[model samples]
Target: MNIYIITGTSSGIGGAIARHLVDAREGVITISRRENIPLSRIAKTNSSFFRHYAFDLTQTGKIPELMEYIFTSFKEVKLNGIALVNNAGTIDPIGPSGKLDVSGIEAHLKTNLVAPAILINEFIRLSRPLKVSKSILNISSGAAHKPYAGWSNYCASKAGLDMLTQSIAMEQSAEEYPVRIISLAPGIVETSMQQKIRATSAEQFPMQKKFADLYKNQGLSQPDTVASGIIPIIFSDKPESGTFSDLRYL
Candidate 1:
């Protein structure tokens, strides 16, 4: 059986992705602030292929233990293959860098950059020895490759995540037990993050109107649709490692 460990499944793209994985009969462990109820229902109605862990991703200090527990309990099931999707993220401190508060940036960094790095490290350590297909997909953003007026902290954090993906991939390429890794930009989906972006003040976010217009024009992709589109790439044999790409382009 295929196993998928994903974060931030309480809502939006993460939640949608979890649902798809579970529906596809893959055992899924969801890490989020709250349990994903729809997925929990699937666990009951389907084949008990779902596990939920409730914890705040900002509490970075506890991630090592959490990851340790997951690997230990599930390591025996490592024969088939396993995948980790670092999908939890934030769009906070959406304003001018000069006016940003320290706490907001720190929180954003902890959630977006630091948490993923720690998780990736632990993931590699645990899965390296297992003789099975292993993959790590970092849910990157378009901001990582672009400069937005009011997303300094968000952009920088994502850019850092992309770099982390690159560095880890490089080390794994020459190793005996390598893990497939990708920093994937999922594109703009109709999620709460878009609402937050559209609700920003025009003075702080000059392009707020553009986001609003995207919603108005029904241009945003559905979360479930995007989630479905991404699974094949994550599960397929076409990729090895050091893949930094956007889902739309793929």
Candidate 2:
């Protein structure tokens, strides 16, 4: 049996990916901060191989133990672990550079960069003996490459995520570790996150109108559309390891 882990399953790309994976009838373990009440039952309709963990990814200190628990829990099963999607990320503390919230920066680093690396570390250690193909897909953003005024913290975190993905890829390639890493950016998708930012006061969020106009005119892609492109890349034979990719390429 093949196993995969995906973080963030409440909504947006995370939920879309979960549904897609379930429909594909593959064994999956999904993580989210809130309970996906419908998902447990929905997943069973097409696939019996599904599990979920509702926990905060920001708590990096507890992750190693959690990974150990998962390793031990699944020890009895024969497994080929393919992918770990670091889809749980956030863009917060949005403000000018000088007035940026340090707490938000810490939160961004923990969720976007630190936790993913720690999870990868633990998974690699635990799965060393398992004879399976391995891959990691990190959900980054165009914000990482482009400059967004008042988005300094978000940009830095995702930029760090991109770098981290590259570093991991290089390390794995050097060691011939079976794992491959790809950092992907899902551009301008319509989701609740966008809504929240758009709802904020204009004075507090100056970019809201520009973003709203962009979405209104450009027609933002749906989460499902992004997921469709992501699914193929995860299993693609093309060599995109240690690289950043835009969904339009697929």
Candidate 3:
């Protein structure tokens, strides 16, 4: 069985990835702040293969507990492949560095940076005993590579995440059983995050017009389309770890 644990699946890119996995006949487990209506329906229809956990990601302390539950619950089953996707992220509090709220920046830092790193570490430790192939997908952003005006928090958090992935990839490079970890930047998908960008004032988010133009000109990529394309990469042998890849470049 190809088992997957994914975060921020209530909607947007994360939700699409979970749906894609299910469609491919892979086992899926979703963790989100709120219960996903569509996923709950899937669970009812495919009870044996689907699971959902409605918990807050900002509560980073609960991550280990959540991972332990998954490990214990599926202990007896022989696994063919295991995947952990740290896809949950926030792009709000859009403004210049001095104008943005410190509280909001703190929240963004925790959700985007801290949570994924912890999950990646815990997954490596737990999967050490399993013989199955393992992979981790860090849903990254273009902000990781280039800075955007009025997006100090978002840019800094993503850059930090990219570095974290790079460091861990090297550490596990020569392990007896290596886990492939890739930080993927899925590029301009049409999701709630885009909507938030479109709604922001030009002064607060200088690039607001660019985002609005994308929406108006039908330039946004569909979340499901991108999800379908990226999910297959996890099962492929290409793209060595510690690499930052973009779907557009793929």
Candidate 4:
């Protein structure tokens, strides 16, 4: 049986991914800040092979304990552990770079960068020891590759994450771990995060027009489309490590 782990299953792409996995009868272990309400709906629709783990990933210290529990609970049938989706993220008030709060930056770093690294570390350690092939799929952003105003902290964190994924993939080649790491820019999707961006004030958000124009003209990819393309890659034997792809590119 293939086992999958996912973060931010509370909503948006995370929830959509979980639902897609269910429809395919792929087993998944989902983690999120709150109980996954949409996952429950998915459970009602397709009940087998899904488990929910509600926890705040921002508390980086708790990750070790969580990993221990997962390993211990699933030791018997763990060979098929396939992918870890680092999908959890946050983008608070958009503002001028100088006006951003220190705490807000730190919060984004922890959730967007540090926590994912921690999870990747634990998953690799567990995978090697347990002898399972695995992959780490990090949901990065276009901001990581292209600069956008009023999103300094988010951009920085994502850029760092993008590099981290590349570095990990390179390291995997050298070390030959039975795992691959991919950093994907999921492009713009219609999510609550977009709603937050649209609500920012003009004074604080100078580049709001760029975002508005993107959404208005380009529209947004449905979460299911991304999930469909990504899920196959997660299970593929092709060398996806160190590659950065977007929905359009896929």
Highest lDDT: give the candidate number. Answer: 1
Q: Rank the candidates by lDDT, best first.
A: 1, 3, 2, 4
Measured by C-alpha RMSD in angstroms, how accurate is candidate 1?
Answer: 1.2
User: Per-residue error at 220 for model 4, in Å?
Assistant: 1.1
- Judged by whole-model lDDT over C-alpha atoms, candidate 1 comes out at 0.87
Query: What is every candidate's alpha-carbon RMSD to the true fold?
Result: 1.2, 1.8, 1.1, 2.0
Kindly indicate the candidate among 3 and 4 with the higher lDDT. 3
Clashes of each: 0, 0, 0, 0
lDDT accuracy of residue 231 in candidate 2: 78
For model 4, residues 6-124, the per-residue Cα lDDT tens digits are: 89987788888888887777777889978777677666677556678888877899998897787665666646666788999998746877888888877778999999999999988
Model 1 residue 226 CA deviation in Å: 0.3
- For residues 65-135, write the lDDT of model 1, one tens digit per residue: 99989877666563588889999999998999889989998999999999999999898988877877888
Global lDDT of model 3: 0.87
Q: Residues 76-170, candidate 2, lDDT per residue (tens digit)?
A: 66776567888998777777777767787788789888998899898878777777778888898888898877777778888988998888777
lDDT of each: 0.87, 0.80, 0.87, 0.80
Lowest-sum lDDT 10-residue window in model 4: 73-82
